[model samples]
Target: MKISAAGPDVDMIRVDAERLHNMVSGHAFYSELPKDVRGKIGKRKAPHYLRSQEERNVASSINHDYYNSATMFLSQYVHTLPFALSQLSLTHAGDSGALQLVSMPLQYSMPFMAKAIAGIETLWPDMRLEMPEDVRNLADTWDLLAEQGVKGVGT
Candidate 1:
């Protein structure tokens, strides 16, 4: 969602269009596909949003870092059981330790969610949408909570 909102500023549509054309024209793998399929894929264009060249720059650099951090943490800690298990330090061999292990990662999602909400709030006008005042208030509340850190709150 955040990336799509940042697409216009980053020339993502143009890049993706070029990539699609290259897949059909430059790659032998796509050459093996049916002509109609290749043509359909090649002709497809990403939807555009109006923005001046001056306005388009690396406006989403921070979001990119957030995305990379989330991806790396999830891959190593949450997605794979063995990697997750290797990082665990359980003080007790009971349900409390097991629950604590699971909740730690889940609690880490608060900041990511807060960032997503902030991105949505920032992009709402460009999207021709009105974010309710209550949502903004809720996001502020979430941001405050996220700043307090995730330790000693669960399990």
Candidate 2:
């Protein structure tokens, strides 16, 4: 699938969100801390530490905020692939050329296709997207692509 930033013409870029997550999460600075220390420093689910009133002003001074930010940023980037593909499909009106948009969903993957469409709308202001009437069941779509020798995102 073609994707572009800041332009109407779609472009191909090798963006493996999993690899990006691995790179970020596997960093010694982020990963070497003891689990308890990590837990104490950052919320396990929320991606950021809770700052008390006294800490709020100084908290913003920390340089590692982006590290904390990456937790959710990378999570969303990794998890949003299928939804992105679906939205891209809609944007192209299910043009077969967009079929290359592929994603391997994680265990928590649910129907975020609508969020993806909204993201596309926000990202591409003038573009219009619509889901195709002939959209196949998820399994069938994968099977059909597999039969045609199309390697999926993970391969």
- Model 2: which ten-residue window has the lowest total lDDT? 102-111
Give a tens-digit lDDT track for model 2, residues 36-117: 6556445423235444423542342222332243344345546776645465546564666544333333212222343344
Candidate 1's displacement at residue 76, Å, is: 2.3
lDDT of each: 0.56, 0.43
Itemize residue pairs with steric clashes in candidate 1. none
Model 1 error, position 70 (Å): 3.9
What residue pairs clash in candidate 2, if any at all?
A: none
lDDT of 2 at 7: 44
Residue-level lDDT of model 1, residues 23-90, one tens digit each, is 65777676676566556666663224333222332343223343445456677764666766675754
Please state the error at residue 4 of candidate 1 in Å: 32
Question: What's the CA error at residue 72 for candidate 1, in Å?
Answer: 3.0
